[model samples]
Target chain A: MPTKAMFLMIKQMLQRPFTNPFPVKHAPKDVTSLVEKIQKGEVKIHPPVPVPEGFRGKLHYDPERCIGCRLCITVCPANAMEWIPELRKIRHYVSRCMFCALCVDVCPGKKFPGEEKAVKALSMSDEFLIADYDKYSDNLIEEPPEAKEKGI
Target chain B: MAKTTYYIPVGPIHPALKEPIRVEAEVEGEKIVKVDVKRGFAHRGIEYMGMKRNAIQTLYLSERICGICSISHPYAFVIGSEKALGIEAPPRAQYIRTIIAELERIHSHILWLGVIAHEIGFDPLLFWTWKGREKVLDILEAITGNRINYAMYMIGGVRRDLKESHIKALRDMITYYWEFTEHMKEVFLSDPVYKARTRGVAQLSKEMALKLNVVGPTARAAGIRMDVRQDIPYDAYADMDVKAIVPQDIVGEARGDAYDITMVRLYEIEQSLDIIEFCLDNLPEGKILAIPNYVALLNKIKKTEGEAIGAHEAPRGEVIHYLKYDGTRDGPAVWKVIAPSYNNINSWAPLLLGAEVADIPVVVAYIDPCMCCNDRVAVVEDSSGRLLDYSYLHKKAVEKTRKLEKELGVRR
Candidate 1:
């Protein structure tokens, strides 16, 4: 056996665990009440390592700014977004989204020189915890209360 | 007296096999006489889906072909699409792509090493190697914004720019990985048990490798100097000098077994670090993306109707994407993606023959077979007069899934 690896292994044994003690550090006495505690602000949460910059996570769409151009629907690979002509907005399926952020890049919302306003309305948010059981739920789509623009 | 023969079906799903490759091995006692391989379990048919979407949309589909070599498909697809459009990605974009691709190779090789070590029952080495691999993944996540399906490649160029911060990160990453390589050498290379389990076992002759038409490290391990980066030289590889790492270069001779593959892969991880460093040092400063707007890119693809083949050197081997676009269609009229594992799968027949039943996992892992890519490739094989079609394979896969579900229920 090499002296170096042995020493290193020994050092590792003496030190704290390399892995994060996630649940072991924070598990409440009663397991089912953990959710209730979190909701009631009785339990503090430990966040994961901070996400990187430009990390494609949850979808965030601005209805007022959106032109309903259908560029996002046209470009989504996973068929995650659908153009609803009646609503004059796009319907996004968060469950189906690949988090590719192609729609974010393609959206023509950013202002250019001599341009009056930003037209491309869709963008991505850093909120990644968006998974849910129901695929067609209120959380998935961006059905804003106001800003109902007529179809151009 | 006739020798007793037993046929063992390893998987459509087995604990030993990582992917859904069914290996029907004809074993006489402990020695494998002949092995028949059947795929088509993980075929999601992204290529067929690519045809339904626009060219820009298809790039995302290409990225999902195999999670391991995720960038390779999009790299080839974009190159082919660019060739078809008669536009070139700026020098800055090419160099950035080169950086990402090399980084991808680093992670892939390290991942493969960990898997191979696990297969050989070297659990300590597996954990140790994977620990080293996490650094690469962190850098990748930092650079491209995602870990696996990077979505870094745009049609004409890369989506993200390698900023000053990214350059500093790359430099630090190179330094960290270079030191990690030294530790890896001390741990894995000097171990006699690793050498015994790997060396001389499942030795593929140079002639057999040539006959099998293997690519990537497997080909290099067999003394065949075949590398797509050296031959085709897409991205910044065309501009920079790349030295192909063969088994002989490291271990003094080509054994073309598990050990040589391991050596070739380990060496490749070092080479990738060198390439990344080179790219950062000589990186051209400009815009990251070639196409100004998304529709402008779509318009170019919409107008152009031509055929072009793009090849990328994935960590496993060569990935070729052939795109045929008819001007009228929203997407490519025909999109054919041939991943490296598709070519490398053919060598398994010769490699597995005469090997002991125990060596099956190592032999299979030697090819670093990505069945998700292979499943897309439909092979019609005729055994004597019996022909196996898509329907037959489909039925077999469905039956296996149902059986598994039933087995789960019974266990519950």
Candidate 2:
């Protein structure tokens, strides 16, 4: 028994617990009412710990910059991206995405023929908590409308 | 007349065990006479999955084999794949891989410490140890982007690079963690309760450990000087000073008990931190990822035909991946994964044979069995022994808990 450990144990006993009581200061008896109260601004929930830079999370698609190369479709580990030849675009099913971000790395950040700067058509955003009951829910997929005309 | 022996089966489904593994013990009045371990419930056929996919795809599949040792599987797989392809990762890439591997070890050993403490009915130490582990997870999440399944490895090199900020974060973390190790040593070595519960229980002699071929901390606890990192230096361990921490080095003698296992892992956590710091200081500058384009790497693998074995010292023990690539096939012709638990399973019989029923959880946890990695293991019980189901094992485990609770007067 080191004296430091004894002092540290005593300090821990006297101090507050390390875990945060999230959703509210105290746990609510019922979760549904707590949510309702949160929606009504009657309860203030603690924000989650901030994610660091370059965090791989939800898919953020920019169809305007896409060349329709389907490089992302080929490299995605989860087959999360679906090629839409009819629309000359790709649709991402976020639910199936493994969040490995290999597609993001493979997608060419090349500048277009006349463009001055390079832009990535597919990228991952920090907004990760995208859980939903419906797999086909619109919010769960990322299919930004193509900025170019259908026949460009 | 011979004394009548009672047969008791535990798990393949029990509250204490997270994975599906059954241990049948033939007992005589709470004293275990013989023990047999069974597996085969949690098999997802990961090796078969690896054989059906290309090397590029199988790398990610390997990551999914064991959530705890996720980094280790891919690390070994890439090494084997690289050997077959005849391409070596750059100096920088190797150092980055080493950093990630050691960080994985810190998180894993700390996680196991909490689990082993919990099994011994000490929840305070479990909670405190987990608090210490969060710092390691933060460093991991900062570098690899995910805490558990870090998808950080590629065939030629690692997927992510360490920036100056990442290096600073790692340095700060290692400095803080060095202080925490002292606290861990005191708690694990000096706490009378931890000593009383673990110290001479589930002894696996050095000779028995060598005979059974147990690797990693379990073997190290028994004073066997065997560590894959030191035996065959892989990645950046070739550059760093790799030392095997055995129980004899710390506690004067190798008792081959649960306490020694705890000491071995605690010492390992400290060693891992030191390795991480050394890698950061001596990190060579070059491209973090090799084969800038995926298509080129894929095509290269398509033309290569060879078989290679990659062995990595995972936090648990040693994980070996054997891959046979055929030029014309989409994936390897044959893929076999030998996880550490596959080798450590043999020791369970000897450790549990003569132990009391109350100590079943601690003894089983002593091996740190990762059945999820070695999915298709089986038990070899006596042919005449009858089988038992889940409910019977659950009731027995519950009874043990009740006995402890009553003895401690926690329950009315």
Candidate 3:
């Protein structure tokens, strides 16, 4: 117990703090660069460029290449992916995606592709920031602008 | 029924359990005679997903298992994949991995300290600890692009490379953290209230801790010096000076208990700080990742069929990932994630059985049970035959938000 107390006291006495005098002094090494990066707009918040080669990016869906399988929606942990019945396509809201990449891995078409290159890929992007909440709602379901105009 | 004791089941969904876990506490006149833990609430069938996803995809999926120890999970998984493929990360990549892992340990231990303080009703200590933790998080956000899921670990190696500026940042953090340690020590260790509450509260004997095969700080607290980093010597740990903090010898004396365990953690943070500094100073220069050639790597992975166990000492405890792969794309993995909480959970019975009710939260939090990860075993059921609507309870709690807002003078 005496040793423990001594250890504590020594630790307290000997330890030198590294906290910066915030707003007066420059930020700590990590924070300084972070502030610089943010100021330079280097860290993209919205739809950022995806890192290459097997990087899990934003959910990509090709309406033309659709086999209309709901495997992606069923496996989504965050329930971000939903199948649009009217347009016969799968739509994903970026806000709802947990980036778990369950959909990308589970896509069977990638396993047995017959032509059209199995239209699903996740390109890495840093654009995670959502500027407009309503835009997400707009992209929630797939419907062509012409389809809405024709009312067919 | 021969006069069965009244059972009060406490979770599957309860505020006390961080993730949805249930506890059946059998009590007679305020004395808990028997306690059963139920889990499986937050199990996202991660192993099943691992089986379906390719090796690279599994890296990100494994990270989502728990938000707190996110880095450790993927680190273990990626290392396992690397072993299966017989690929070694470059020297610089290995150093980066070590630095990031230690940074994670610092963040996680600090967070646990805060949570423990909050659970024990020491609000001020909790606030102060979290405030200090932000420094570590700031470092994390800078080093890795994101604050939470770092996405740094890749299959062959890591994705990001450390710049000279990054090294300087780490050095700066070490200095700041050393100073912050004094404040943490004063508030958490020296404070009379904290010591009185935690000192002998959750006493687990060294023999019992060993018998349970407990890993990490819990085992270390009980005088068992076992750290995977020291034992296995993976990545840059093989080159670095890694020391395990044992409670039996702190300044050449034996002091073992909950408080001693807490002290062990505090000291371990200092040790980690030193390791991070050493890694930065001696960081070898090399490629961040092995050159990307999918076909050859895929074929190599397919040809290798064996099992390897990768264990990492996470902030919570020793995390072991046992991987069995038969060379193929999307190979079957019998992944057994033995988190620190698993070993410490049983120890809780001995710790909390005879303690006061106020001591329950503290004792439970001390183990830092990743209940979300461990909720696969037990289920708690309310015996009233009338199920409690947890959402309704949440609604009631949310209703008080307005009053809390008014208290904060939002309307004014």
Candidate 4:
């Protein structure tokens, strides 16, 4: 039986490793130069595993489709949503968000004028690389267009 | 000359342990003469937080209690909550819930197998096992959108409906695990080295397992056919006949050792695969949620006033959740979770009493102990060997506060 295990291990040695070694397939010296090469399409980068449909990740809040019902605020388990009372829009903190997408589900998503597609106010984007040094960093917060318009 | 003894404290943080749990073993040579397990390190006060939130928030919060048993906890929570609210998930949703729960079980059991292998210094086996485990996790990701905290289960029903592609993926996963479990049984059960390491180690008698109130595979390995699924069926489990897999069925005698547990877990994976297969065969057609409207469901929860206990046979053991809804709040007024590790950890002290130092990791890991929910009150023992009660602790706390106040020259 141990022989079977050994054979399995030996077979594994001959076979390609199952895991997808992301970013780069092998280690590289002068990583910034490698990135430059990658940017110039001089070197091929190993791709990360493809995520499935409905993968919960960094959220995208559509300001145009938002009704500002505050239901997402009420349903968000992490309490990551703060209401901008003047604009009647909610600001979402990505660092605090657990990515359960309960907020996305409770959004009562709608279609805006001249748009055929129904867009949920809150939706999950595939962009998972949204980490930042500060919890309240601009990258982590979803500020509505109204706030941007007022520059407040 | 008489033998000398050494006091070995195995952890608040040890490589053998995954979580913070202190095991004090008085070793007389290699054999342990005494053992004491001190827990309560990882308490999150989640119940208090749950009581403060609305029902929907609390539901997702329940799923966060444990990473591996994410489905199990929410399964129990929703079952209890639905009982309290008199809401029944439709037939299709129930079937889907069963499928997801079984997928989790398959992944969890394989994970434990890998963990036990890693504990025994079998790195290749751990790697091999975990590599196989990726399939189930992928299928889980495809189905629930997330791998670990699958925010799928709702009080009335599930959030997402299983698509045809999802079902196809699950079937492929089931086929993959079938052969994988067969290989596991061959690699683990028949391997002389594995047997040498695990045989007769962490042996729990049926009597001892019952006395300790052990649930899930640990108790089942000890030859006790106690499973919440078999005893008190819930959701789709009620529609199917589920039986507890014990070591006796495979080996003709139950050793109740770490090896036997390995056997039990292996067989349980097969069982889970069968359950998933059955769920797929009998897949019903209908809406996923009983109350499709979230606000309406919360409103129904707000008007509901009742109490119920929900128990799910998790991969580790039975996860029980007691919920009391008092009409005023949308969430349960009182929420208490009983993770299987709470009872499963009880066997460790007894099992370790006469175990060798080499057998320590096996004994510690046999129950697949999760210390997260085992936390309640921490007992402080004085150096003089007196167990300080809460009142005495409170008195000492007050004294310390006053002492700090005096030192700072500040008064309230």
**TM-score winner among the candidates?**
4
- The TM-score measured for candidate 3 stands at 0.72
3 versus 4: better DockQ goes to: 4
Best DockQ among the predictions, by candidate number: 4
Query: Where is model 1 more than 4 Å wrong at Cα?
Result: A1-15, A20-29, A110-120, A146-152, B379-412
Worst 10 residues of 2 chain A by lDDT: A143-152
Higher lDDT: candidate 3 or 4? 4
Candidate 1 residue pairs in backbone clash: A108-A120, A109-A120
lDDT of 4 by residue, B78-105 (tens): 8998888888899999999998898889
Model 2: interface root-mean-square deviation in Å: 2.1
User: Candidate 3 chain B TM?
Assistant: 0.86
TM-score of each: 0.90, 0.89, 0.72, 0.93
Kindly give the stretch of ten consecutive residues in candidate 2 chain B with the minimal lDDT sum: B375-384
lDDT of 4 at B292: 83
Writing each residue's lDDT as its tens digit, candidate 4 over A42-123 gives: 9997776778899999999988778889999889999999988888888888999999998888888778789888779888
Judged by DockQ cut-offs, is candidate 4 incorrect, acceptable, medium or high? Answer: medium
Residue B24 deviation, candidate 3, in Å? 2.7
Is 2 or 4 the stronger prediction by TM-score?
4
Cα deviation at B147, candidate 4, in Å, is 1.6
Q: Once model 3 is optimally superposed onto the true structure by TM-score, how far is the C-alpha of residue B168 displaced, in angstroms?
A: 1.6
Q: Rank all candidate structures by their lDDT, best first, as comma-separated numbers.
A: 4, 2, 1, 3
TM-score of chain B of each: 0.91, 0.90, 0.86, 0.93
